[model samples]
Target: MLVSKKIPWVIKYRPRKIDELVNQDDAKALVKAWLRSWESGKPEKKAALFYGPPGSGKTSMVEAICREYGYQLVEMNASDYRRASDIERVAKVASLQKGLFASKRLILLDEVDGVSGVADEGAIEAILDLIETTKNPVVMTANDPWDVRLRPVRDKSLLVEFKRLTKTEVLNLLKKICLNEKLICDEEALKFIAEKSEGDLRSAINDLEAVAEGAGKITLDLVKQILRARDRVLEPFEVVRNILRSNYVWQAKQNASQTDLAPDELMQWINENLPLQITDPEDLWRAYEALSKADVYMGRIVKSGSWDLLAYATELMSAGVALSIVNDVKSKYRWVKYQFPSKIRLMTQTKEARALRDTIAELIGRQVHASKQKVINYVLPYVRIIFDNNPEMAAKIAVGLNLTDSMVRYLTQRNADAVLNYVRELRKAISEEVKASKPSKTSSGTSPPTKGKGKSTQTKEKEGRGLDAFFKKT
Candidate 1:
């Protein structure tokens, strides 16, 4: 039986011809003209650069156009070839080679902006060399052509901008997909996804797929769940701005409920930015008072495990806080860039530092006969001082502890690249050690069955049974 493999919706529904591309008529026309110029032996511009925000169909359009015109597409990402020598070895050869069966070639360098600094030495020069010498047309795609590194490529190529798909265009595409799949989907849900996508058709399609999983019908609630899980949360600044500006309770409540933030996180954001938003002293004081009450409700909810109290907590934080502003002072509130809560930022940093500290303590405790707490309090300070003074010793300790590059950097305050290189060497050594330790097959076709924990396989199985019987009695 031949079972067909299931393809992803993104690939399955992707446009295979240029005309099928949405809201990119100008780009399509420009590309078509550029490709047509190649028939006369050489175009005025040897290459065309397609640049736009991701999921705007830049790469897809170029590929489809090449396929439609029977041109052989040679695709390469900039990340794959970082050095001048790497580019010269692969791209230079590929560019000069003629396609079999009279098919014209098109070399595509995708995400050219990623090649950077020491890694990209001579890469730009090599690409420029190709532009001057290659008979075939070259195409490149990037999210940003205006990026400083891509200037040389931009100068050598004809720039064609791919604009984002309009909301109507995206919604129509979603509706068409739903019809093709024969999946029931709410119109409002589709529209919401389209609007929220902010012109990225690819993201909207992915979101639709996620929401439609394991379901015959797609509901607004299902769409909301997908959006929430994806963290398509309300921007804190926007939410804070609206809350302060809203005069009616329902409007404030609506704004608050729409956000993915819990009451506590939302309260922190408001607490951080409220003073800047409101100029009136009395309004500021009133808002803080409402926040205090919201905190109290949150504490009670925590103590009692009363999830139903969350609604009351949200109301106090949002509507209560909004209504606290005096009537005359309501119009005084103006939107500014909301500052992130410093307390939250500090707490996050502290948490990460504590985790790293605990990891180190645990590693040391395992080697020496002591608790993690004891190692942390009694030994870690001396270890830090030793690591600070001796780089070689630090590297040895890091490998012995099987510590990651990030952990090594945090503890020793060494250069990131040096720490990463050391960690990589340690990992390679460990991998080689494991490979060397594994038993090799004998001259016979079949290898002997392996023992577990120095016991024969059968004996290990018996011990497993005995442990199971012991556990059952307990």
Candidate 2:
């Protein structure tokens, strides 16, 4: 007798035919068009880059195509091919050859954007080189196609985009999975799970499996217990809506725990949308008063380093602000579209620029032996002035201070390229001077130093001889 193996619902229910995929008609149609283009021996674009949110079926859809069309699927994880040599050694073989068992092959490099840092710059080039020579189709996927690192591949390949599945789509998929598994799952429970997933179908399936494990039936209470304990990256809009709409104190408090946002960040979100939710002036005043108290708690936490105050802060922010809508309770239940905090938006917009400024300050601080703030306010302005006015002088300072190319660029935007080139020339000249002044190789391979120490001092400094001298003195 043979026992059957249990498979994950995600894999077990993966679409084997193109038609099985839902809510992706455009992507499917695009893929099918490309597949048909293969009939002429080659398509206009030899490669396709699929990009979208996770569990949007980027990889699974490719698998379906290969299974349905009788083409062999050769899957490669992007992490593995990090170097040019790694790609050449592995992907090259997969790309140029027909599958041993099938007439055609599809080479998939999954999560191309996840290749990581400057280390994989060569791997990207190698992939481009592979595409030029391969007789087969090369497909890559990423959560973000706009990443600067993927710019080359973006230009070189056909781009196919996928969107996060809708709540309705996820619900239908869950219903189908429950039916197939013959699991007695409550409809409300399934809907709650789908809502929690935020359109991540893969996570929703896994969530369902988790809740159903070792149980004859799944219930709303069971889902709530498990999912609440499992934190997710919740959108501020969802979190604030849930918290503000919650009727009871515990419910509002529980809803606050749904997001992974920092307490202060979440505070900004709540503060921004509070006015939109509470219309009456008196009710709005009450909400703001509670929010201000929460802000007080935050300041205390920062000043006194009392983390225990965080619970009170969270309570005030979530439950306190929420329950303050007592003057006109009907406004609390009204549907209001929320906006992200303008404060947070400005911070986000300036974050990279601030980081660059801080990095430049830190570099300068190392040479000047000053605090980063002091250097930023006092020293950087002068450096910027020198960079703009005196190219040669600026290059010397850049080299002397060991500032990187980006740091120099940060100092002066207009003269960045020229200053960088001058800095490079200075470096080359210094390197050659050091080389020429290294003193021609000695006439003798090994010679006694004509330098500092006397013979007795030298003997004492020598390793094994020190012990002998100690014995002689004794």
Candidate 3:
């Protein structure tokens, strides 16, 4: 019986040492320095944050380092340690205690930036706290370090950036893998795969494995075929051009299905360029009408979790939108450059602002004991007004809520320096007030026991009325 080789090429050929990692010398050096510091009993930085594009050797490098140095790795992905309690249970325990067999422990939080919203409440703060007190070293990896959610974590950890692998480097790695696998691969085939991978070495290797899985030999033609079939393979512009110019419904549908663009994404591209392609106003209206119907189908699919409706959504968006153009004005469509969807562009531009808004909403919900929706709809507008009218009150609220500088600036639409100064002043004042409220020591240098102070009945009623008035403005 011929036993199958089950090990995936990507995993089987993973780098085993620091020197084995490609195009990430700086990252390797930083990680080595961090490890050496631990040996000296004084770490320069307790945590190292690795940020880069995917398929780079961030995770592999950390794992290799831990292996080489005989450190126990307590690894957890974002999904596993999403909540603060989860982090405390796993990471906190790992950090506070010694390893079973290894000399030292390394807490590896992979894709640290993936933690988000309600699920990740207190996660960043928890990580920051861990880095401060953990006897073991902590390491984190993220695709985007500048993510607003990661700002606190970024500040606490030392940042190590991993650059994308060069095309030549990727090509060389593929050749080596092919040689080891004993698959006869042509130079042009390997080069094509490397160029198409766009500096993602892992993807290049996976693609090579896929093409050479059962084939006796790899050729340039096989590489080209695989590249063409890759998902979302068609450029948005070309897909839009074909959808607009094609007369046959089947041809338009085939074009839509062949390319990797999802139905909704294809619709956006078509919607953006349809008017520019079709000169007639009636055709434009009809095209938009088809798109609207397609969106209705999409809504149903989302609500019902029924993927069967996807066919209808695709047909309506593709052929239905294409058929709306009755006039044979192919000549006019040639000169127009396809315009990208403005909505997507706007969303990309305001991503950070939106994240800040959601953060503020969550904070308000916790403080007011209201749902997030209620806080956003009924309370946030008034809070903005209050911030504008009373800076001191706004500063106090910000401090009370533990709002970050970025959050405050985004919500108040103020300068960064101004927000930072205001927050600092408010924090100082709050600290002083707390100091004053504490009982003083007697002549013997011992404080006297006193009755605990609680909110008075009248004070509670007055506060209730104040909140009532606040909501009335909203």
Candidate 4:
């Protein structure tokens, strides 16, 4: 038989068993207890789960246990090798198999915690069935075990938690690997790796490999260079905090936008965290004033198609905010969550109302032989008076204008009574306008209004008619 190919560094270096894994005493004890149950030939635990952060050797330890126990390995990843048929087929064979190569077969389920939805629903059910009936012990691994669906499996299985690697553990591992590889590195380099790894041993090892590749001696400078480039972008939260602590408003403002964050999002970040940064009463007011100005300009740009004006608004928000902080005392800050402006939410609601109102206005204009703009500006404004004087007229106008109760209320000003009255009158006015404006046989023969010379003549005739009508009515 062909020999299995050598595993890659990432896989080969994976921690094989709880005992071999670093810095997880609690998880090791639980695994040992499970293994002891098997070693004693007592009914082996149905399942054992390894759960923790990524690169923490959870999978490696399980594999190591299988190897140490002389058990044949059947490994499947839930992410890729997952399907109802595949799971059922595997379970069927695994259940029937007496042993592999004269050793007991161990089924390893990877990322079982990810099982969910209709796609994996069958797979989950199959696994649950296997857990109940399977002879061979099953080992599953997951980054997070707190998922709701996993609760059943978790309760049935022995749960072992793997924590993030400690700094000391990461450092020791880094040093051990470096020594093995014949690479020379300083304590600072090791610390950098440990710190950058953030308790991820796999990341630390990978980073060390990257730094040590083709190197003579690993210096702190080299480590810094590598670490700096591999670094994640600075969080906008930190930038906001720094700006808040800055003495110079321009400096703080300048740094705020310099962060690789969107200006609009940056504004939100600043706004959310401003209170935390600027604690003084007066300073808070000043900061809000700047924010309000920024918001106004932002609104203007949206309304007017003037994208070029965004910069001024951004600068106003950033710099103006920077000036709002009272003191320049630098201090540590916790992360603050940003929120969307409530006014903006209200404005969005208002826009919907306005659109519906406009549609109604347009329909009314069509029926009344009046422009929509004129109806909206001139006629709707008088709806309240019409409602109080004549309810029938108002109802007719409502039917004519196609006004919804909500829109009528909204256009009727703020109060409920005013809204109802205005709505009634508006409807009546629209209906009357539509009826009066309906072209008579004589009016139907008239030509359309014209521009320039004809417009002037039309204007004069209209004015003269209005004057004569006003005098005659008086």
Query: What's model 1's lDDT at 263?
Result: 76
Model 3 over residues 238-292: C-alpha lDDT tens digits?
Answer: 8888776654455567678766766677777887888788877877787789889
TM-score of each: 0.50, 0.50, 0.51, 0.49
Residue-level lDDT of model 1, residues 70-94, one tens digit each, is 8888878854555778777777787
Model 1 local distance difference test score: 0.75
Ranking by lDDT: 2, 3, 1, 4
TM-score of model number 3: 0.51
Task: Count clashes in each candidate, considering only residues at least 3 apart in sequence or on different chains.
Answer: 0, 0, 1, 10
Error of 4 at 293 (Å): 27
Candidate 2, run of 10 with poorest lDDT: 460-469
Best by lDDT: 2
Give lDDT tens digits, candidate 2, residues 1-474: 123237777887788788888778888888888888876776988889988887889988889889898879888884466567878887899887778999999988888775533233577788889888888888998877886767888898889989889999999999998897788989999999999888888999999988888876889999998877676656889999888876445567889988888999999999999999889798789889988999999999998999999999999899788767655556766898899899999999988778888987875675467999999899889989999988877877676556678778878888888888887886676555534545564332243333322133343233122222223333
Worst 10 residues of 1 by lDDT: 465-474
1-474, model 4: which lDDT tens digit per residue? 123223334564666654778888898788878877866777556888889887788877877787777778787775333466777787657865877474687788887754531134566677887788877778889877887767788888888888988899989977877786678889998898899788878778878777876785888899888767765456776677666654343445556655786666667777776776556676688789988898888888888979998978876787677655433222213355544545455657788877876876775565466898898987666775665556545544554344567655554444446546655654455445534655453442263543222224554343333333333333
Clashes of 4: 10
Off by over 4 Å in 2: 1-5, 116-118, 232-474
